[model samples]
Target: MAATDTIFALASGAGRAAVAVMRLSGPASGPILAGIAGGLPPPRRASLRRLRDAEGATLDRALVLWFPGPGSYTGEDGAELHLHGGPAVVAAVASALAALGARPAEPGEFTRRAFLNGQLDLTAAEGIADLIAAETEAQRRQALRQADGALARLHDEWAGRLARLLAHQEAAIEFAEDGLPTDLDARARAGAAALRSEITAHLADGRKGERLREGLLVAILGAPNAGKSSLLNALAGREAAIVSARAGTTRDVVEVRLVLGGVPVTLADTAGLREAADEIEQEGIRRARRRAEEADLVLAVFAADVAPDAVTLDWVARGAVPVASKVDLAPAPAAIGGTAPLPVSALTGAGLDALRARLAEEAARLAGSGDAALLTRPRHRAALSETVAWLEEAESAPLPELASEALRAALRALGRLTGRVGVEDLLDIVFRDFCIGK
Candidate 1:
């Protein structure tokens, strides 16, 4: 992982394809390419070349492109070899690269170099990782916005203001003996209060960004033989769970992924809630209650022909969406616990569309469109929360010196957020999850 060592890696997908791209970055990139590819191709332009080994034995014909330092990705001399899509071709090229003193890149090494070289901040680097792993259109848009520096811009603006306040407070303290303006301390405190308010407002976004990034969890809960599994199969358009006439057919949680309103969601069908004597069924019931607690939304199902259980009624009273299952067999009650139940018959496919539409609406409301520069990670929230605390300290500090120290601490927290300063320990944690070769 040393920057002085030239690194090479397969940047494209593995296995057979139209082309396999081998990426290189370091000071020796140009020389390494020239050593193996007959000679360096025109910088930033595709040029056909016959790649060879150290012994000058031809290996493969490839398209080569050279990127000079200070302007390329990683801010270093880099090159790309578009080799023929074959395992042997890629292996030979990799061997040749190693023979020429270029070692294989570690996971996220290329992007780490880019960050160290000032090409991007930590937030942008994380955004790139999220973009690579995005599963839906909303996630993609959000990742792209963060990668394009939207989040960085917002944080940097706040940091700049905080820095100015710190500077003003320091000046007031340092120049108080020289008869400087006495109101400087008061002005800096006022500015701290204003900045704290803005940051607090941003923090109160209902965690929409984090929810959107991680996806939402919805749990289906009901008593035995309440048709909960049947409803799950109907919503998923597949028999994701075992449906049977037995009371405890589902003894564990079954989950399925679905996209609602372009936002990814995990729908979990848990075991029917009940007081069971069987140890296994009792365990399942316990797990079901735990899942319901963790769910962003819950579907409290009641059999249309049977009386609603007290447990299910309690969930509905706690804001769960009430669903009347088996509507084809029996008419749904007008209301359950003062809340109108959504009538649905999984067997006959009746009223399913309306229920799906309602779920989609809830999903959209919980995870908004990815248009705003929202906080997408827990680390971001924690850092901002610490910053707010420091700002409050600065606002209420008894001495100007203490206020200046608090302001500096707040700025350092912001610095860690964007990798502007003091992030040596965090580099590994931040980039460990990234794919190799970036």
Candidate 2:
């Protein structure tokens, strides 16, 4: 949408409530609000006003606040109308706004305007979206950190260093006849190498930020009737998966969400893993193996009353947490697959707390506490990866000119990450997922 167009949107959650906030931004925001509210309220101070249509028909009385240009959220004129939240009141006020030259805002248009106006960078805009969608305490804190520009500050610092290095490299080429330090090129390459090493170390974080942002996946795998579904239900505190005595009862994966150690987790109860005569059962087993392979963590369950099957034992050997289920029926084996199995009786609610604590510890280990500044999206990782590649090229270039070009390209990549440059195409992709009026 054009920035010249006056945009307005319902800023609060939709539906009946005590109050609804309607936001407006653009050059005409002040005038349109003035006309509707019988003149603009003192800038930044809330004033109750009678909102009316162009024909002077009363719409709704609203608490209005005006924000003058260049100092507002979008770095332009802005206004907010706090109105009675009945649907009729909201509709009437919306009609009045449209009649006065304001158009409905697209999803995330407000935040997009903020980015375009230099009020906040692309990373911070993304952080705002993440904060809105955050489901757990960890997610909220991480999003808040990102929205507050922690990632942007770190990236900008790196970009500034790289820019200085590029300038030095270019000086070496441009002033070679004047003898502008023979070691300039060498120092630039050394700096590039140092920056590349730091970025590479950042990349080796085991995807903790990404895991915490998107939540971790834990898959439960076991033989038929091995109490896999029972364990899942117990952990979820609800019957999320079907449990039955019949073999191959759960023929598909069932998933439930949980918060472990403040990190969001998706726990999947997969089909039983075993050879089967039926086609459906074989397919189920195949899916169980695939889920385990894809999961961030795997819970390999064995029945305490039955001998550990070779398939489950193999999974246990492959680093899956061994769990001896149905402990109410029989004592757990001293060890399974060279590791002690966690004994649990889902029916009796015995050892469930310990199991939860163990899972929480694992979850925290896999996804670190959200206090540190971390890359929260795949695009962030991709941009940094591209930057690292260019930095490496700069360090190894055969000529100073080539190294300078590589460093420039690296700066462009970093620019894309923060929307400082070359980001017209990326704006849509970045903001499309945000809610309207963000």
Candidate 3:
């Protein structure tokens, strides 16, 4: 599409609301705004107008806002129309714009224009996409940081440092007898070490940033009548699954999304694992075993009335955290050999605070609160990992030229993280994940 041809999309959520927004962006923004509003407002200002078609027939009374070229969202020009939130009104305005040379925007075309216009870096553009698609608090926070160019700024600093290091290396190698300093080797290695430490620090957050961007999966598993579903409800603070005095009320996996300690957890309360007579119960038990294998953390709940035993010991091989549920009913249990068992009661509030605190502490550890690392996405992790591999190369050889080359290679990989120089294919994946309106 030509950059001069204006693009428009319904910026507001579809369906009924108090009002709807239709956005137009391009060089023709002024004309389009004038055509719809019968006049263009002063730049960066909003004005109420009676919108009409080309024939002067009334369409909808809208509040029109205009943003002049070189200073607007798309960097050329942009306009917004706040029309009444009726489907017919929105459609009519859109049809009118189409008749006047505006084309419907493709998915993420608006934000793509922002990127092309240099208003946002590739990372910030993706952050915009993520922010719009955010479903949990943690995801929203991470996306907001990304959209704010936090990752881009960090990557740019590293890139600049490497560029300077590369320049010094070229001078030392090409003109050693010239004025190049003798500490070139030392300086280059030191720079590489600094960059490597930066990368290593960011990469140290083992899969927490990934889990935060994409919600974490946690499973609840244990013996029968352990109040597993009750614990799920207690943590979820709602009756997500049925609870009963009977042994196996939940015969299938019950999954729910809860912000446990500020991180989104897709908590799955699975069936009670035991030898079953019925076909469905046996199938559920099998599924429970399968889920335990894939869980990020399994909270093995047992009644406080029962003490730990060898049968329980048989199932603790997968790093499951033993949870003594219904702590109000009996004494709290202890962990086999590690941290103490977390005591909690689904009915009373006893030990619930401790559970939340423990979960928060675990989440913080996962997030690398102990380390001053800034990682926001899984893609970032992959790029940092590759960069760290090259840093390892530099550390081993310690040659100025090799270190410079390795640092450059590492910078290129991180550039992909922020879409600074090369990332056309990655942008396709990022924008494909965005909503059409975004």
Candidate 4:
């Protein structure tokens, strides 16, 4: 990462394609592009050019782009070479770049430089990563909002207020020493309290953003022969789990991912919950209980034709969705576990549409569609929590000087979230997960 050394990397996905994009950024980007592409093109314009090696041998005809300094993605001289997507062509161009004194970029170096040059903040940078990794439309929308500076704007607003408070606290300390009457101290404390309340409210978003980012986990639990596996297969629209008439057929958890209400859900069909005599069945039951406890939502199933087991009934009492499976076999009870069961027949495909709709509704409730600027990472939560604590200390501090110090600490925490300040230690961590050439 020598600032003076030009770096180049394949910005496009690695595979044989029609064209491969080679991105270059650094002080020598223009010179390196000229050396290999025969000469630089008009700034920000792409032109057809013959790429040649130092030996003056033609490598390939390609599209060459030259983006001159102070206006490019990294705010430095940069260029991109769209070359034929062939291993030999890529290798020859890479060799030529090295010969021209340009090295390969490290992971996230491009975006890291963008952040260093103030193109975007840390939260927005993370949003870029999320956007690239998004698997659903809802996820893409949320990531796009964050990348468009939604979270950054919110954090910057709070940071501005915190800075003002610190300034007022300092002013109050100076004015008191000079025996001047001023309400600066009271104003600073009041402002800190208000900001603290706002941050607290933001932190209480039910972790919808995080849940959307990571996806939701729903576990199906019930006694043996309760049709949990059948329900899972029906919901997945595939034979995802082996079915059996015998009890304890599924000895482990079977999981499948599906989108419900635009939220990705990992639906787990677990072993029946019961006191088992077999050792393997006992382990399966243990895992089933553990999965149920850890799940974001639970589907406690009971057969319409059989008596509901108390173990699963307890789960239903604790807010699990009660489902009456095999509805074709017998009529569902008026109520089970204090609520009306969702009558469904997995074998006959009866009531499955309603069941899916119900699951989608629950998924939306558990993990929101994330229309608001929500915190998507645990790091955001931790930083905001720390900021809130510091604000509380600032509010209660007896001395204006101490209060100012607390405000400074709070500002540092907020700055870490948006990479405005105090983020040198986090750069590696933040960018390490990024793909090379980002």
Candidate 5:
């Protein structure tokens, strides 16, 4: 789709850097540079030049770069002004471009234009947004892979298989009376079942990828004086929360994020659970329970001095791992430390390494079995889930006609993922999240 107007924005981050870049695109790109910088650079070339305004007023001695249409990012003619990194200088250049017929690029408009011109597919484009928003190293790497078309490639592979299978099904259904090989129907059904299995396994991976992209929420829960505050501070590696041996010191839930094995995991330390006269402490306890249930993992912190009791029992009922804190103090109750319950002392740093390793292993497991092709966004997961549902239905179907319909529906959903079929609504929402200069 060719857009009518040109757009421009400060491509470089706003800061006191030595130089800043302002990007322009569309029909007016060449003219805009010519008006401000005397002349345009050759395609993909940068030229030294002095920039000026409409009235021949000197703005800044800047480097100008140009790219011709149909090949550049945005698949349109584009230009860049490497101007001095000053707010006023950048603003003057932007104003000059606007006067020369370029409008301010809306957030993500540059990438949006790139998408419009087929420079990147919908998933890759969204991957750009995800990459920009990534919070941890693993998130950055994962988003970068998606931005490089990992999901797109996987989807294309499945789509191609389904397309071939659909062809066979259609031929069998359409020419059955011509003494078509009787085994064609059976073969088609078997193929549908196999494809359904593939999609089912693929969609199952969506949960872990989503969790890794968003980071897992972990809650640290226990009665007051259970070393919850100490553990929070210890895990954070900084004094994010006040820590003391005094009971009920932390009256509110405190959150901290740390990278465990390249995965970002959030830890929440909640107020100690107890019969309390303080309303604030009671409120904290209530919030703690709510967050504990929402947590991807809950750490039931109890000092070795305390007995294995109802508080830790409730968490175990919901599949939480009971973590025995203060292993340096004394031996924990025999009931608490079994084959799975990990013990650590956030005080003396005893067994903390083992705890961290365990948490990382769990995060990795939840994030996927290391190499499963994961859907990085909710949109991808939703599409995959819908497609997987149909695949399941198709697998159980005996009639080739019903199975073929289900297979077609599944193929259509996968098609929407890679833009082989139009996803205008999805595209609109996805591109809307981008920054103006991409």
Candidate 6:
């Protein structure tokens, strides 16, 4: 919290490895670097040096770099030490850093300082966190765009327009006493309406970006003997779920994570949907229905050898992918619920590659393929929604004064989205989720 104090942390993963990166930032960065490495390296240049302890004992040979204030990541003097990653080496360096008046950084403190010093906005800070947590290629692309200020640029453009409207409205108020023949108020109202419409349209994007950020969920549903578990195992390339000839073998949802079309997906193999005599089986059936309702996509599986069940046929009619399993046993049905079912033999690996390709295409359609800037978090949605409401109120205000007030409120809401204004309360919520090293 005190920007004047020096902070240090392991900028790399903590463990015994080839190298461990210890980062320092604050006013004392230069002196701390001097104390440990005997001198500062050229700005932004890496130099090998002998690291020493408080007793002037050689701790380890390391690489050190120094960055002067105002041009560094934290907008303050900063330094980095790449030392051999052993517990003893790290401990010795940490002890020397403490002796030289630097303390351990809190979670996100370095980035928080960067934000405070105008290196990046709040939204960009969040994007950095997302980039660190990203698990798939699509996710990495999305996070990288966000961290580069895509969302901030969009929100800033809106905020700039709102500011212009506020200024116009104020000008109208100031000149009204002179009886000046002007239509500034009318123009302001029209601008508010147009901006509100644009924001609303942006909000209508089916939450594809958020799903991509959080990953997609696909549920497998079918009759008791439809080989749903077997299909799940076949796609996951492992025995993720137990397959049995007996009905009701899967009594709960079995989840497996895999990348499809460069998007992370959680594939849930659910209990078979059918009437059951046992209470436990009935509970499993209830859970299956719930999972289908919550899933972004559903796989309606049917055994090729068995007559198509009406329950799964209904799901196929309702837009689920119709998959005919057990193709090795019998030929796939030409038509299932008025459409061709994708035939796959989960037992023999026949037609599985085609099924996987189809699923990947569907995932790309439902979740984005990382082509555009998307609203990736719930906070973005909420803030934009609130801004739209305020803009609407401004457009409909009876007086220019009220309209100006509403426009200011709208600007404030938009600011919160990009961390350009009114961000004191949001820092904790945003940075607390970050890993300490970040």
Candidate achieving the largest lDDT: 1
Q: Could you tell me the C-alpha RMSD of candidate 2 in Å?
A: 6.8
- Across residues 1-438, which tens digit of lDDT does each residue of candidate 4 receive? 337878999999887889999999999998888998888789888899999999999989999999987888888899999999988889889999999999999999998898988878999999998999899878888999999999999987788778777777877888888898999999999999999999999999889999999999999999999999999999998999999999999999999999999899999999998889999999999999999998999998999999898997899889999999999999888898679998999989998999899988988887888688999999999999999999999999989999989998998898878976553333343335423232
In model 4, where is the ten-residue run with the lowest total lDDT? 429-438
What lDDT does candidate 1 reach at residue 225?
94
**lDDT tens per residue, model 1, 21-133:** 99999999999999988888888999999999988899999999999988998999999999998989999999999989999999999999999998999899989999998
lDDT for residue 186 in candidate 5, whole number 0-100: 67
**Per-residue lDDT of candidate 2, residues 1-438 (tens digit):** 338889999999999999999999998998999899998789999999999899998898889999997889988899999999998898899988999999999999999999889899999999999999999998899999999999999887888778778877876786675655578899999999999999889888889889999999999998889999999999999988888889889998899999999899999998887778899878888888888899999999989999989989888888999999999999999998789999999999998999999999998888888888888889999999999999999999999999989998998888878876543333343335423232
lDDT of 6 by residue, 1-438 (tens): 338899999999888989999999999999889988988888899999998877899989999999998999989899999999988888889889989999999999999999999899988998899999999999899899999999888987777677777767766776775687779889988999999999999998889889888998999999997999999999999999988999889999999998999999999999998889999889989999999999999999999999888889898988999999999999999998888999999879999999989989988988887667789889999999999999899989998889988987888888878776553333333335433232
Of the two candidates 3 and 4, the one with more favorable lDDT, higher being better, is 4
What C-alpha lDDT, on a 0 to 100 scale, does residue 100 get in candidate 6? 94
Give the TM-score of each candidate: 0.94, 0.94, 0.85, 0.93, 0.89, 0.93
**TM-score of candidate 4 relative to the true fold:** 0.93
Instruction: Give each model's whole-structure lDDT.
Output: 0.90, 0.89, 0.77, 0.89, 0.79, 0.88
Ranking by lDDT: 1, 4, 2, 6, 5, 3
**Superior by TM-score: candidate 1 or candidate 5:** 1
- lDDT: which is higher, 2 or 6? 2
In model 3, the worst 10-residue window by lDDT is 365-374
The alpha-carbon lDDT assigned to residue 243 of candidate 3 equals: 95
Question: How should the candidates be ordered by TM-score, best one leading?
Answer: 1, 2, 4, 6, 5, 3
Per-model C-alpha RMSD? 6.8, 6.8, 7.5, 6.7, 7.0, 6.9
As for candidate 6, its clashing pairs are: none
Off by over 4 Å in 3: 135-139, 176-181, 245-248, 275-283, 309-311, 314-319, 327-329, 334-339, 347-349, 368-373, 395-404, 421-438
User: What stretches of model 6 exceed 4 Å from their correct place?
Assistant: 421-438
In model 5, which residue pairs have backbone atoms overlapping below 3 Å? 107-436, 108-435, 108-436, 224-272
